[model samples]
Target: METKEENFPNDSTMESIKSLTEKDAKTFLNLIYALIKDNENPSEQLISNVLTIFEKQLPRVAKARQNKN
Candidate 1:
């Protein structure tokens, strides 16, 4: 898949973070570390805040598949 910054909302970037794939998640985790690792202050709380507004598409997809059964 193409990784485009514009693919997501700038105003709600945190919300978008929650919906990332496993690979994307790993990449993002690394990014977070890179941003804060040097400061001795990486915030897990910030990550959770982002996830709070994030919606999970996998569950919806699974539900749709079940409905098609």
Candidate 2:
């Protein structure tokens, strides 16, 4: 019996959600949860990896999306 309070991610989570695509963000969040389910140390290597990919594509995506406006 989980409460509504336990179902929502906090502000930082929202920000991360905003930073990623809906599909990718959901996948990422699930992966993070799985990693933590083991109760082991969480290294942000996957995050850094994703950010590297995003940062590389950032300029192009921004330009393309901006042009659509």
TM-score of each: 0.32, 0.32
Q: For model 2, what is the error of residue 62's alpha carbon versus the real structure, in angstroms, after optimal superposition?
A: 9.8
Model 2 ranges with Cα > 4 A deviation: 1-17, 42-69
lDDT of 2 by residue, 1-69 (tens): 869875455554454445555666566556656655654444566545444444444444445544766
lDDT of each: 0.49, 0.52
Give the per-residue lDDT digits (tens) of candidate 1, residues 1-69: 637764454543444454445776675457556655554434665544334333343344434444766
Error of 2 at 24 (Å): 0.9
TM-score of 2: 0.32
Give the Cα error of residue 58 in candidate 2, in Å. Answer: 11
lDDT: worst 10-residue window of model 2: 50-59
